[model samples]
Target: MSFKYRFAYYLVGFVLGSFFVAAVLTGKDTRCNYFPNARVLNDLRNKPFEYSKEASTVLAENWIDTTDIKNTLTYGDVDFDKSNIKFENGKIYIVEGKTVKNQAIELKVINYTSKAVLKEIKKK
Candidate 1:
């Protein structure tokens, strides 16, 4: 139509397009756990059961046997001593040992988003 009208319409379209693009880019969704670098995921996957101080405490308190702890690494459904489990910063700490008096192995789950433990699967 008129030059002034065309200019106004173009300006409005540009503003609206910018807003749409910003919304799409800024919207939150499930982010890949391997953020900043994918190598962290590889590292975590390679050794998911590394011990931490808290993990050690949980394991020692929970009476999870060493063999059972190892089984958890490969098996999906190793029974966890819930009393010895704790969660922090999207990671799960599981303590496994034969008894409270024995040394407990710490099982750390990397990149765990949810606090709930997934059902353990039997070892094949």
Candidate 2:
């Protein structure tokens, strides 16, 4: 084989190898329990609420009602109830209902690093 032909063969082999490796990596279910969606009560738990610029503007315009806006965010595809969601900044807040008078219990995100409760507020 000529020098040019050998170089072409080597280049093609390298490209094919890279493609195969990429396919393998993407095909595997690398998602583990540590994934955000894998957590229990994820819908009702406070988490980061990522929204596009346009969506955020729309949410702010239409959903902004008083200091506390209900139904500002919806947990789509999640099994938890949607009425318990509230969006502020980039974080989502959720409240679990207890009884008629003490229903609104706030669930705020502790911090970005931990998935713990930062504060709990009961409706007065």
Candidate 3:
């Protein structure tokens, strides 16, 4: 077979394989949450969240709101070194991100079975 013919066959196979994979994964939430940070953040995002008194107070004082908190959780970096993953009640995760106004913020969240509790919030 000529080089051109072989190249055409390979290109066709690649395109077909790509299409097959895309069709199989279309309309599906096939997100890869394999890493600890991604898995923890995804788990926390899925569950409903409650704010503690301290957290709420910080939010109000800093001109931040629940929306900002939610955004931070959705796009924050978890500080595993400062988090207590083996707490007796539940795992506590410290997530650091910025507010909508570009103000830096940090959130301490405790993950429970049913819901997550925003234990603390601070402007950083």
Candidate 4:
């Protein structure tokens, strides 16, 4: 088999495989949350959320709302160095990102099985 023939065959196979994968995945919620940050964020986003008193007060004062929090969780970066992932009750994750209004903020979230608790919200 010549080099050109083998290359052509490989290219054809690759294109077909990619097309098949895309067709299969279309209209499906195919997510790749393999990394720790993505995993934690997806888990928190799916569960019910509760806010502590201080967190609620901060949100109200800053004119932030659940939509802002949800946006943060969707696009935030987790500060693993500041997060405690081995807590007894639930893991603590520190998520930092911008609000809908482009205001930088940090969130302290406790990830429990049933729900995620927002412990604090601080504007940066």
Best by TM-score: 3
Clashing pairs in 3: none
Order of the predicted models by lDDT, top scorer first: 4, 3, 1, 2
What is the model-wide C-alpha lDDT for candidate 3? 0.88
Among all candidates shown, the one with the greatest lDDT? 4
Please report, as a residue range, the 10-residue window in candidate 1 with the lowest summed lDDT: 115-124
Reference-based lDDT, each prediction:
0.44, 0.40, 0.88, 0.90
Error of 4 at 17 (Å): 6.7
Question: lDDT (0-100) at residue 14 of candidate 4?
Answer: 100
Error of 3 at 86 (Å): 3.2
Error of 1 at 13 (Å): 71
Per-prediction tally of clashes:
8, 0, 0, 0
All candidates: CA RMSD in angstroms?
A: 13.5, 14.6, 2.1, 3.1
TM-score of each predicted structure versus truth = 0.27, 0.27, 0.82, 0.75
For candidate 3, write residues 32-113 as lDDT tens digits: 8888888888889999878899887777774797888888888899998998686667899999998889999899899988
**Residue 57 lDDT, candidate 2, scale 0-100:** 52
Tens digit per residue, CA lDDT, model 2, 4-118:
9999999999999999999998989563446443353443334543334443453355323212322212221222453224434223434433322323333333223334333
Candidate 4 has a TM-score of 0.75
